[model samples]
Target chain A: MARSSNGESVFSRVVRILEAFGPERPVLGVAELSRRTGLSLATTSRLVSELVEHGWLERGPDRRLTVGMRLWEVASRASPALGLREAAMPVLEDVHAVVGHHTQLSVLEGREVLFVERLSAPGAVINVTRVAGRLPVNASSSGLVLLAHAPAAVQEEVLAGPLESYTPHTPTGPGKLRALLAEVRRTGVAVCPGFIDERATGVAVPIRLDGRVVAAVSVIVPNDGGAHAQIPLLQAAARGIARAMRPGQE
Target chain B: MARSSNGESVFSRVVRILEAFGPERPVLGVAELSRRTGLSLATTSRLVSELVEHGWLERGPDRRLTVGMRLWEVASRASPALGLREAAMPVLEDVHAVVGHHTQLSVLEGREVLFVERLSAPGAVINVTRVAGRLPVNASSSGLVLLAHAPAAVQEEVLAGPLESYTPHTPTGPGKLRALLAEVRRTGVAVCPGFIDERATGVAVPIRLDGRVVAAVSVIVPNDGGAHAQIPLLQAAARGIARAMRPGQE
Candidate 1:
């Protein structure tokens, strides 16, 4: 099913080459790419040059290569992620203004939750999620909302094993997580306190389209006593986003 | 200077193949790609297979191909665009909340304005800019700010001629555009009405970093009247975004 039995096709090797980059390490030399991808120097060089020629990778003044602007432009245009983000932006802005906290939009991708968009206040509570970044489906409030509506297989597989907890409050066992997920489904909202960090409590609500939950909108509030007002605001924002995403409207 | 005389490098070809996927047409057949890229069918087939193997492209149920989630993940992770967008998001969110219009961040990419982000209210004013899309330098407020701050040679090249006009309000003539650019530099903002469309007004302010303009923040207000209130909010947000992008901050 593949080539290079380095067990990767030229493409998979290329993808492996790209997967090495992150927020921390954006630029890399060919050697670094080869080391990271565990590909040979020759193969890495050839592929790197090819990518550079195509504008998928750009060579900077220091001769380090990074994912090119062209690649970003190409990948971004008309993506499902882009559509959801656009549709949710206005409502998210309203929520952010009223809440004055971290407003985020996430969708289920694979067994994890991928953050599609997020807006933070200058002095808002610290958040671990980033746009295009992923969090475990069992961790963030956005993740729980996404996971609750996720396919049954995904839920079963996630609940089957090793649920990593970021804080003592994060549900580590299957039974508790299942219950929490059930609550999320029933209430159409999830509040995760000290789940990712002790200082923050995340409140999220699901955004649905075509009769299924397609996205989740969340706000990370500083952990405090009773911010009961957040749930309704988030739910209203989610509904606004859902309405916005519908065709022939807005 | 380029190895792509036939205008094909495995990388560039890969980019072309990827670029063919857009918001309106996210999936296409190999033959469609071949025609779209002007690459031979054989070449297109080989490259598409390679791209799919690499996770840069995915095969649909109908045998069409699309830009893959993996590619978007990797590209978005490493892009400089993300850094700019992140720094701008909090402030942009504020502007979106305050003005309740189209809030955008853009940078100069050659002679065009490359929009990195856009946030709009559900019923916000209509705007032509799209995230990851480009607009001509003389036709967008963001473009005007970048043009005003651009190096002399680049500025000259852009102002010389062949400026495409989107509407009568577009500053296409060299003399008038030069004056407009100077005005933008003087006030640190550009107010463009009907430059791209008759019903919209784009007001942009430079986002300065290290005493230089690195990006522009703008809001598209309806031509009807609310333009005045939007400018101050947009300018303040632009300043905030600039401050956030400063070294060792946020």
Candidate 2:
């Protein structure tokens, strides 16, 4: 890759510019983008124009830049998770219908739990997880299940302390979390009350493919002693998803 | 925008490389990518390596390339359609439950109908539409509805001919399509039985925001004498989604 005089590759600069947009700020002007990306205004303007012309970015009526539908189309159609999400959708819908709250599918990515798909009712329990959103691998039930199956290096890195708590019930200490992980690995499920929010409980089960855990199926419901009852349903859904995602099944 | 010795911008080259991966071929090796993108093997290798480092592409165990989850994450999170899709989910779910087949949400993009989201049951009906897939504007019910509300230039362009036919029931002539577009605009719905497949019927209605058509919500069901009955339910769902997508509701 060719680099500029400042030793930055065009690819890296472009990534920085794209990263400036998020769910909170979906549209921005070139000036705002330059400020956010720490790039000079001239470079930002030229790069934005090129991106717009290529359909990876769009210029709105007000001239603000937004991520384009074309980019979304390409990313979504070629996504590695598309097959997994497609296979999991029906099962997740069934789980959501039965559990009557937030049902989610997530995978461990870069020491965090990235939600690939989520189904929620209008008045379901409070859930901070969104599709394509990330939660720390040590704070949520899905994260706990994934952490339980992660490599020893990742486990030790997360267990080396400094795990932030979302609520009083969230496990922040290394010793308690180690015990919880052992229980999850043994029981094939992780249940935590008010781990993410004080008003909700999260239950998750590992989804295995070819005898290896690839994802987690989870549901969030009211923290009212109902966590254990939802486990069987989640486990069943996880099993169904695993079958659907098996090699040659997709 | 510095260009290579051949005068092609790096951004355009990158776009071509990304576009080489699609639904039919989601993974490719460097040699195959070089052939597909018309870029030299060395250039393709350098670009692929840069993209892999940025998490825009991934190398499989067998050394084939695939779209990365991080790219999907960024595009899905920052997508302009996210707000509309989020607001339309519940309505789509309700329609899916009632319709028990394929419920799709589509938008017009560059003379093609792009399906943004789709919901399907396990054994509902034989449908060809997939999420993030595209269909010509003259071949699908959703396409007709969108084309009816599209600009006059786009209408003329489609009407100029070369309308591909998927089934005998599809309108191939300019005269019949003009009539169909008028009927769609007048009735606020497009019903085409056996348009795409002999076994399925397509029923669609336009979803409007600020008095302008923004998308089409449609359902595909078994091609029987029951398409008209679904129009009312589909129209109601479209109205609900329109209401939900209005400013401040999302």
Candidate 3:
């Protein structure tokens, strides 16, 4: 959520302050946050002071500010990502060890694939996925598997809009994308070569919880060799994750 | 922040609504939520309606509301737990593969040991520790290591408090705990036995970043062994995590 330059509400301002901290800019000073948020310096100072007092933000020894442990603790105790991510990590780890590549778990959020966990090798094939990061629902194999199982309206929304092409192989046409999704649902796996990068391919299978496709488990491997063989491994991992989500079933 | 009994802010109400959803109960009806939150049915309905509109909560096909991916994405993206966790996974995986027990990462937060990550084997020793969970600063080995290195004020506050004992061996007297902390600092390893549970011992070592102890790496093993033997392994793993955390180290 965003607000106008000069008339933003306090809640929107707090959201903006948190949003200003990203992967590349994890820590910043109040002045930098003020500049980035387009808020007055005095307002920025007041807001940062309030947030810090509430334990939502913490100032480092260098006078730079970052997200607070309290906020992380609260958020971690929040059930959406933490519970599913916790259940998936061990299975994701198993897949990573077995596949000797990058293993990731993601869910469909709006029109993007929001990564929950990713485990990678030191010199694994370069993967663009990052934990808590997003990829277009039509660009990555995990996204496609999720987009395939998504409701028709969500699919229509994604297919009707801007489809970003991270690499030349990323399917941009809505018609081709629709066909790809249909194939994904039919086959129960999405395999893509050079969809996000030329040298990497993504293979994914949907993870179901309570008979719904709640998440997707995927692996990133070199574009060469039998990438197709990775499908069963991913499916097994997905089954394990689904079972973990449903404890009694496990 | 908790508001006085009545008239809570919408954000606070939304947070309370979220807190109602836990790992045990991931989904509930709107009425069930209201009953759990003590909010009027109308107020709960309206707030939950807004949450659904904002994608912070989603309704499943069964008409049950569950923690939505949007909330997860926002909280996860803003979390301090993510960066260090990403760097530690490979190293923790290595240790997990060899040790076949729980491997945990913790940081001192407000005189408590806040666990950022914990990887456990399916049939590993039962532990009370949860990822993003807190342990008393004097009860667990990780907490002991963190408390030993905490600022003097934090140390004093904990020592001045009424310590709660989980088991017979849990040190409750401030004087004894203070001595134990000193011993932990001297040995570079915190050995806690029968504190959390009588069947287990926690072995922890501080992980240094830029020569300051930033976190603690720990493992839980059966209490029967000489815990001193596990120190080298935990210390080496902590060093590995520290090396991974260094700037431009990866």
Best prediction by lDDT: 2
- The superposed Cα distance between candidate 2 and the true structure at residue A111, in angstroms, equals 1.3
Q: TM-score chain B for all models.
A: 0.93, 0.97, 0.89
lDDT of 1: 0.83
Q: Write the per-residue lDDT of candidate 1 for residues B1-250, one digit (tens) a residue.
A: 1234564444556667787888778778999999998888987898888877656788878998877766677779778899889888877766776676788899887689989998766567678778988999999999999999999999999978699988888889999999999899888788888888899999888888888888898889888765766767777787788777886774
Candidate 1 stretches with Cα past 4 Å from truth are: A1-7, A225-228, B1-7, B29-31, B39-66, B122-124, B223-235
Greater-lDDT candidate between 1 and 2? 2
Query: What is candidate 2's lDDT per residue for A149-245, written digit by digit as tens?
Result: 9999999999994788888888988999999999999999999898889999999999998888899999999999978999888888999999887
Q: Among all windows of ten consecutive residues in candidate 1 chain A, which has the lowest summed lDDT?
A: A1-10
Evaluate fnat for each of the predicted models and list the values in order.
Answer: 0.61, 0.69, 0.50
Candidate 1 structure, TM-score to reference: 0.88
Docking quality (DockQ) of candidate 3: 0.45
**Model 3 spans > 4 angstroms off:** A1-9, B1-53, B57-67
Model 3 chain A lowest lDDT segment of ten: A1-10
lDDT of 2 by residue, B45-135 (tens): 9999999998899999999999988988888888866667888888998899888999999999888899988999988888888888899
* Ranking of predictions according to DockQ: 2, 1, 3
Task: Supply candidate 2's per-residue lDDT for B113.
Answer: 95
Q: How high is the DockQ of candidate 1? A: 0.46
